[model samples]
Target: MDATKRPLRIPPQFATYAQKHELFELYRRLIARLLMEKPEDPLTFMLEELKREDDDVPAIVIQGPPASGKTTIGKMVSAKLRTAHITPQILLEDDVSPLAAKGRAIIDKNQSIPMELWVQLIQARLKLFDCIKKGWVMEGFPENREQGLALQQVGISPKHFVILDAPDTVLIERQMGKRVDPQTGDVYHTTFDYPSNSEVEKRLVEPPEGCTEAEMTQRLVLYHRHIDGLRRCYHKFTKVINADQPKADVFSQVITALSSKHRSLAPHIPRIVLLGPTGCGKSVQAALLANKYDVISVSSGQLVKEAIANESKTGEAIKPYVNRDMPVPDNLVLKLIEDRLSQIDCVTRGWVLRGFPRTREQAENLDTAGYEPNRVFYLDVPNDSVYERLTLRMTDPVTGIIYHTLYNPPHSNQIKERCQRHPEDSDDAVQKRLAAYNAYVEELSDYYQTGLHINADQDPHTVFEFVESMLVSQLPTNLDRD
Candidate 1:
């Protein structure tokens, strides 16, 4: 195993287990048989086994040195077992790359990943496990004994652990053969694994100015330390597999090891939707709920905005209403909502509908279109209070900062002061706007039969507290509390 690869370490006690190879082969055969017996129902046997024993879903940890093909093997095993693949490196790369691009000091100079990031990734995987029938294959995670113990505390225990081992000479050969483009940092080997051959050669160069041989050696040492720690902690579940063999042979060994640890669980993940009116803190609430539940927040407003900008039929119909002072037709709004709900994210994590289905026609259309909210929150602010709130709202042209005159005024008070002088609109126009909003609220109440009425007259913090309490009462038990 290339010690440079950071993943879970194998337990030391397992090093003395004389039948490690035999056990791995036996499990692989068992998994293959189970898959063949009920190919159409891969999870059926596992589910039955779990039900009989009242056991939790087993987590499998794949440990190996860098460039030992850990990810490839993990993916193959996960696919064969019909399980989700959770790779912390991939997750962190996706999350932190943008931050790095923005010049944020998030990751260390040596690209050391943070512990909280790993925790969040594990939490996300745990949430996904609730939705999936098969378990998960975690790759590039538990870099040390501490992280492994943290996962164990959260009810995640490795039913089977596989550690790939190769001689240092083999690892050095693989690492030296590694050709990385200095400009793009695109990694390539002796094969057509990357781009053009000429480009790969041109890109291959010595490490950057600061990356001396000693620094590289230290990184490799740290990786070994992590692996050694893992070996000491998870001895019972650890299995050492020789990774110097052919790719096919190595994969066969991995398959055998995973089969014996298979167990099934029911897929009872709830498809929840959060519904509320505009300016009722729906977006903010959705964000909070998404953080708490580890689900994606699919905003209908953002979808409609994109559609409108793209000038789709639904967008064209709403143009006059949005640009002019007219109200959007019910059909156009309904179509926009329908388009949003059809998105893959909405289907998976569910959605929180904000500024949609304001009228009775649109509400009925939602039912006709088969889009339903598990919970609807009616932010019940007094009509006068709402009018006061809307009138005071102002946006800074330069900074895009929103401010309210009455509650949360800007530092200068210049905008509110200027508005007082103009006293812009006629009373009739304001009345008409309020009337339209009231009618929409009434229609919403009637549409969602079990809508929770929250007193929005209180301060925003208090209102949020009330909303949180209501969410706790209505949300699924599996969801985390904010």
Candidate 2:
């Protein structure tokens, strides 16, 4: 009988997996992947990646010595991570190595897996794991410099490295004090998580027969020997936490550390740019994405159109040029955009900007205005799709809220009376806009450091989700408060 198999009811969500195993894998993968190396220019690489349309995910590394409450911390932290928690034990379960058969036998007999084979196995398995979307968190896999360096060679950056530490005495005592249920193999710690049953609870406080002080001491010694070198390997991003304190306290620090680090640029307002061709849902997506991800939005086209609708002096100023679909002068566009950006909505609230930088000169002037976006999203809708979307455009003449008959149709009976057709809604006008877009799209796309290409031909929700998920990847900190 498996002693570790507790008859105690595990949540059905965890019925297929052991709770401990799930937590270990959660953090092991996170920490391993945090060291995911990148090329010389990651953003430039990302630009090329956008052209090819690849998947890129953020990775976190939770590193610590054994019995330092790292696994417990990993378990607690996994609940908050947006990505997968990957552990070393997952490697043993999904082995394809030539020596996997022998490795299985050795592990079953309780022998340590050899180092050379250990590295190979971990590297191989990680190759298949996906960190291209929601990134991953890792725990308890890399204990030495070899494993750490091997991970970097595999192209992962150690963006966040957290080390859980405790006094040698406390770690040994904690390990030695644990009571293992021989029948169920469940481990109970008197100081932390303990079972509810009286007998099980009693066993935790009083170490059972197999629990010994010696093994704990031996394990601690072995861990300390290699921990220094391991820590040095990832010193750049390492954050140390004292695990001798209460688990909750230690975990709180873990949360703060991970949150502020590579989790997303914390405390830095997300500056995002959504530059795409006309009618590619750039305006629609910018508005949706800004609302969904908690950012403000401004569009050059929207601003000019709004000015025209308001019949402002600037509106009449640009009306002649707009009537002919001719490009508005940069000075006129920049002034309107600058004034709009200074308004209450865009000042404090981070903005998703579009439309101002219509040319090389405008892009340079945008820099002069002290606006630089960290993330750029390119809506790569097919030309035909762009034309189709533009042709269907409708707008509420009163409120200036945009709608599409198929995509964002207005519900009110007044739509027929109140709505206005976009001047470019005609087939020839749509074609002309697309042609103009193609003429300058490459230069504009190349102006930024990196941009993510999105397939906007899909449903609105899918497009928004992809853009939102990408923002979450780059700047995941939720700005949900004052």
Candidate 3:
């Protein structure tokens, strides 16, 4: 993590005995050029480095004054975004009103915690997490300029900073309105959420002297002093939301801002939709394209199945139809697919969607969700080819690697021996899937005005060559690689 101590570049040397003069000169020039290269910005370098290492995880930071809704907003954003949420309070001492207020005197008077102590807390807390890998949404750390610099020093630059802004009056009202259940850590607000009975509520507690107007004014002063400088530091990635608005409106603004910022990180990544029949090698091509292009491959069916397995709300709603061998309603399916595709992984890494948009309605929904693909690939293989490939197909369940008994086989028998065969690889199941795809394939294709139609009956290499070449020609040169 040290920004200093860049690796030493050993100078090139030539042996006296029988050295090729041209090669020696080339080596000397290369070494000199290496020495002349300017040093890199370590923070920028580390940002790229971690994205490559943890493509699926997105690290986020939410910053605001004490009562600007950082905690509530952080929690909601984390759930909607499906990323880890960490509050620095937990990084402080175990049990207190605000965990960050350890030596309570300074903080109790609406003053800043020591810069060194705050930085140390962040460092220790981060060490316990694989934040680089799974990503994180952090709240209430980096309370001021120095702490933000400390974060930079540690090579942790967030993808986005959500900065909530509100008037002093609004923040004061929020602070006064909110109450906490220390036993369960459940927070309630006077207007948004309240106890059933004021007197009968055994759980309620009176506000401390800190709830008074004078104390609130001091807290506001402490809060504003810190945020203005922090905002200046993170202006490029900061989205200022008005916390004075209604709760739902504020939340909606936060979601839109965060989502837009995340997408902005990856400008034009050749977002693609692979549409074809079940046995037309859609999954195979999706995987091949993802690997060659260094992007993500998502299977819509698998996403739906996963939702079902997790018993999500969407899954619960779609359970009856899916069980009855009918397609899950477009609304539920589209929501699930939209959530998956909008994740940080897809935004930054790029993505190829499979088994999605089987019908015109679903395709329209995908467009509504802002998934207008750079190109829609329709693999046009004959019915005979489809059946032939399906009958011979076997999958390694552990790896989800598709193999055709006649066309493609495991190179080593040892691997072939251990592969878990999927139960649905049976011919009956394959026919059912193929029949379902055939019924609606025409309508799906008609949904798009233009598309790349490949004769998938050809060998895999030839088809992939055409598809990749078309993508290369269409996408900017900046794309075609991560």
Candidate 4:
């Protein structure tokens, strides 16, 4: 067979291995980078990417407005990580590098360093063997969007870019109380954090002379101007830390953000689960998503009904309890769902599971089976609405389609005349089912920690539009959208 037309056959074990090691996500990131860059030497680029492993090298960026605790948090993080702390002052005062010579001349004239020169200086500094080996935490370079992009162009990327933010009022007050130790260059706020040692306290002085009120105001204006662009550039690995709290709290939050793993910039396989009360439009939303995404829609009720219709072995086992209007065993229901989800279509394209795994045990079972959903939605609707929607609805026997008399009436008289209300749609049956759902709803909610709760009390179209928007937001930030 020709190479282009050859069929791809991935070993079944590859799925288990990929899930364990996240190799699928890694490949997705590599492919996304290739498409974005379109480099000339594709083979060489792949080789370099395979060999490069600096992703966990502890490069960090701390940025904020004046007195928002960037320097304090940066120093704390560098000390905790045992990484080099690189500040702009350190770069400017350096006596060795050639760029420092040019930068010093600009500073002597009281002129700001140009963006290109600043980028070169930072690029050179980070490439030093000490920095490359021990990694580094950068404090106060790339103060604006242009500077940030310039550094990016020279391949200077930080794994974690933290933005410490506080209200202007709070920041201004902090600056008023700001104290500095000239010997150690440590910043402190008198009210929030003071020097405990008397020796340190006695020698503490006000900040250097040139940071006047006008200069501070100008700096704040410039920071606010480019804040949005900075967010856009590093949003994938960015975390905003609120700095209005105590210094210890601020430092703790920064550490937490830094220690967390960076999420993959890969499009995940759509393993979706929808949970809701009986009349919350779970099936309608699931169908809409399946149609739009070309993914399979799996429903336990539908699957059981099909099996009973075909009188298959699994269906035969479930028929007796279902015939008595009693609940089927959890294991039987789980097996049916497992068979459906393990098929080639669901495995490759993806699947949207509707109203299954209703209890905590079932949810645990699904996870143990390696079918844990990446996206879960619990649609919330008012009790009155659920009762109203369920009570007035009937199915058209000929078409097997459901409609409500007040909300979604049949257009033709013939279809309306033939509609029959299901026994399970009666008021008493719905009440019983609702009570059963209420009993375990909390358990299921607690089990799925990352599941989203959406207010689904609106029309079906509006609910679906909101759900689709959430999915679109999860796409890789670097992927181009038309």
- Which TM-score value belongs to model 2? 0.44
Off by over 4 Å in 4: 1-45, 129-134, 235-237, 259-263, 271-295, 299-349, 352-482
- Candidate 1 local lDDT, 1-482, one digit each (tens): 77766434332223223133344544554464464445577677655544442133446789887656677688777767656777764455444444323222355455655665566556655565432456778877787899987776554667788998887566655565555576754455564244566756766874343134444456567778788888878887688899888768998877666545433221212233444333455666667666766555665557667778999877777777778856666676677666656655555555566666667776677766766555677776665665575566766665667777677787875664443311323345556755666767766677677887877776666776776686545221221111
lDDT of 3 at 326: 84
Q: Give the TM-score of candidate 1.
A: 0.39
In the range 350-402, model 2's lDDT, one tens digit per residue, is 67887656566678787676555657888888887876677777888788897
Each model's total of backbone clashes: 12, 31, 0, 0
What would the TM-score be for candidate 4 when compared with the true structure? Answer: 0.59
**Would you estimate the TM-scores of all the predictions?**
0.39, 0.44, 0.43, 0.59
lDDT of each: 0.62, 0.69, 0.71, 0.83
Clashing pairs in 3: none
Any residue pairs clashing in model 4, and if so which?
none
Please provide, for model 4 over 338-357, each residue's C-alpha lDDT reduced to its tens digit, 9 standing for 90 to 100. 88888777878788998688
